[model samples]
Target: MSIKPAIFLPELLRHLFKRPVTVKYPFEKEPVPKDFRGNVVFDPPKCIGCMICVNDCPAEAIEIIRVSETEKKFKMLLHNDRCIHCAQCVDSCPTKAYHMDSEYEIAAFSRRHLKIEYK
Candidate 1:
């Protein structure tokens, strides 16, 4: 069958007079939802070296390291480049050390800039 441009004409006309539904992003931003998962926020002090966040990440983007072997202090590294932002780390963390951030503007010039280490 041949394509018809007229089929879309009525739908286009109906929306033409109405105010634009598109947002003026960058200039203005819509508020994120209360439970929106944007990025990983790690609190070093709250972490108990459980390594559950590291093990449970589906993307394998997170790493937990021992900062001090004698003191059991741990450090966490979040590879945002590989992160899917599923908030699995937040859910898996028993100590509430990991939480999702609200900021969605996660763009970076380089991949290296996306890697975040928490100590």
Candidate 2:
């Protein structure tokens, strides 16, 4: 066996001269995948003020505050800042009241605004 010279080069060169396939983020947003885990949404009617989500949340981000017109029912309050997106609340919700949405832009200057009542 004898090898005088050896050279290996990629055949495609047009891609180098072409515009970038990547997007400029913050200014531009790429489409989220069909199964991406982003933000959470709560369905007030579906939830029976069950404590399953509150109990199961590893982050302890969920709280159920019952409106005491009667001891029977109340609204659920969720703190978005305390949530770590573990999806525990979603998984524990028996009525499918909780779900993850594709909208991940949940940033805010005040943490209080992040808290939302299930309604």
Candidate number of the best lDDT = 1
Give the Cα-based TM-score of candidate 1 against the true structure.
0.80
- 1-119: candidate 1 lDDT, tens digit per residue: 97587998888899998999889998999999999999998898888887778788999999898889788788888899999999988888888998898989999999999999988
Candidate 1: the clashing residue pairs are none
Residue 112's lDDT within candidate 1 is 100
CA displacement after TM-score superposition, residue 25 of candidate 2 (Å):
2.5
Range of the 10 consecutive residues with the lowest summed lDDT in candidate 1: 46-55
| Residues 1-119, model 2: lDDT tens digits | 66434332232454667788888998998899987777778877676776888889988888777666655455777788988988888888998988988888899999988898764
Error of 2 at 98 (Å): 0.5
List TM-score per model, in order: 0.80, 0.75
Measured with C-alpha atoms, the lDDT of residue 82 in candidate 2 is 86
